[model samples]
Target: MDVDDGRTARARPSSWAAVAIGTVAVIWLAFWVLKAVFDVVALLFAGVLLAVFLHGIAGWLSRRAHLPAGWALAVTVAAIVAVLGAGVWLIAPSLAAQVDELSQRLPEAARRVADHIERYAWGRRLVERLSEAQGLPQARQALLGATRLLSTTLGALTGVIVVLFVGLFLAAEPAAYRRGLLRLVPIARRARAATVLDDTGHILRRWMLGKFCSMAAVGVLTWIGLSLLGIRLALALALLAATLTFIPYLGPVLALLPAALLGLLQGPAMAGYVIALYLGIQLVESYLLTPLIQRSTVALPPGLILAMQVLLGALTGGLGVVLATPLLAALVVLVKRVYVEDVLGDATVDQGEGAPLPGLPEQR
Candidate 1:
């Protein structure tokens, strides 16, 4: 009997070792699979954001306008199309003219900035090193870098069509998808999963509202300030800043580069004013626009969002960075509900406590 027990114990260890190896292998394969579909996953998340936005608007229509869900969605789509069409009709000509002018002048502005930079010993050496590494002169290297950046922006523009179509379809029959997702969970946990999903949708809807408000406020303020300072292409530049603001931290910086470059074309004083204008606009967003809009949304740490942007940007590029905040918000909701509440028995997760968001019931 003792010999038999010793043999069984030895067999158990081998079985456990095999299980561990299998688990590790499975995890590695899963990571490889995720990497392959990273762009698709990012676009799906963007689609999710769009669905949340459309649903929020549709919910309001259903509740307040006394419309059926189908009709509400139809109205929402029509309204969006009308607004976009009107905006294009009203602004396209002027915007196109400004864009053309900016394009024609930007190379000169860039050359000027390069000249200024090259006046500094450190800048000259850095440019020389970069130029040598690229097997091109400094001027050619700079232009190549700008061309690559513009190409990347164009690539992102192409992805917007995919996100829009996916979002529209998902938003059209969100409840069906919700039901499908709940079925994926264990039968016993489906109810809890439903609650978490609902809460996630609520938080994301609030986030969408907040982002829209911020974008509008920033765009208007930037346009007003630039116009007051008599800066050219104020409308086009303001619109660019507004659109880019959706990407969070890095976006404003990218917007600032062109604004500052244009400002420098006028004079150093004009450049300083432009810098101050952006700083003022950002301060308002940080203090007022953000606070008011985010009051009912999940408040993520800025540092954490920025860190995720860096990590995801490295892995999946621009799309990852753009979708990072919403993804993090969803993760936060899951961790709080699943890990904190269920596993640790902690009831005080502060899942958007305080003022009630519109279209969402008060949290118990």
Candidate 2:
């Protein structure tokens, strides 16, 4: 009995030591891996988002156009390419010229703003303090920051190309890939995994549709409003707003700065109008557009989305910000499905009446 007890005591210490070593090793490896492949991983996620978008379009074409799945996929790809090409053809020259004009006007606008500020004594003191605080360097830093932001996640052409092809491959054989993913799960849990995946796809599709519509509505409205108010670079500002709409709350604010700056150059009245216009558009989106579209989609909390955006943006820069909401949405679905439903044995409520839980197939 003494020998047996001694053996047990010895075995326990060694086992614990081995486990501690393994845990440390795993953590070190994970940190290394993340550091080495962060950008690649981000690109992969971006590809997945693109794949989801393409798959949604392909599915719609198959159902509505009465086309074979393969044909529908092809048609969707071709249509996207054609539309993009047409947009570039139609808008590139004008956009380029406006961008150049804006570049020239921006410095002048800054000077005008600075002068307006200098008119007030407190503003002059603030300006003087700012100037004393390495003014040239600060201005240079500001310019660099702006450049970085404008460049954003689309900085690497090669990365963009890789993501595009990856998306195409994923969209082309999503079922095959999905099946492959299911195979990774234990046999008992494959069905559950499949359900989760399908639910993710459904939510992603709904989000994409709503997002695109929102962007389009915002862009069109901004352009019309800005043009009516005689704002210069209306098209550019509108395009910027539309593109940034993909980023949720933060995007609109970023887009607003340049528009507001341009409006300031016009006059105080025009600037006020610009601000009111932006607020009105946001109000409509919040009250009308979002609710109408999200009726069939998962309603993500704005605070949660904003938090994810900040976290992801800090980690992955522009790409992370763009993808934050979708990632959060997927995480929410998984948590609700796995933790809330499975672990807690509680039914989660949906935003809409009779809305099925994620991972549940909708009844026709």
Q: Per-model C-alpha lDDT, please?
A: 0.89, 0.86
Question: How does each model score on TM-score?
Answer: 0.83, 0.81
Among all candidates shown, the one with the greatest TM-score:
1
Candidate 1 contains a number of clashing pairs equal to 0
lDDT of 2 at 15: 99
- lDDT (tens digit, per residue) of candidate 1 on 1-364: 9999999998999999999999999998987787678888898888889988998899999999899988998999999999999999999999999999888888888989889999999989988997778887789979999999999888788778888988898889998999999989999999999999999999999988889889998999999999999999999899999998888888999999899999999999999999999998998888888778667877788899999898788768877888888899899988989998898877766745565654568789
Q: What is every candidate's alpha-carbon RMSD to the true fold? A: 6.9, 7.1
Model 2, which residues run further than 4 Å from truth? 1-36, 119-155, 351-364
Error of 1 at 245 (Å): 1.2
Error in Å for residue 313 of model 2:
1.5
lDDT of 2 by residue, 1-364 (tens): 9999999998999999999999999998986676467777888988988999998989888999899888998999999889999999999999999988988888888888999999999999999998787656778889988998777655688778989999999999998999889889999988888888898888878888898999999999999999999998899999999999888888889888888888988788888899999989988888899888877777788889889888677666787888888888778888878787778776745435577766779989
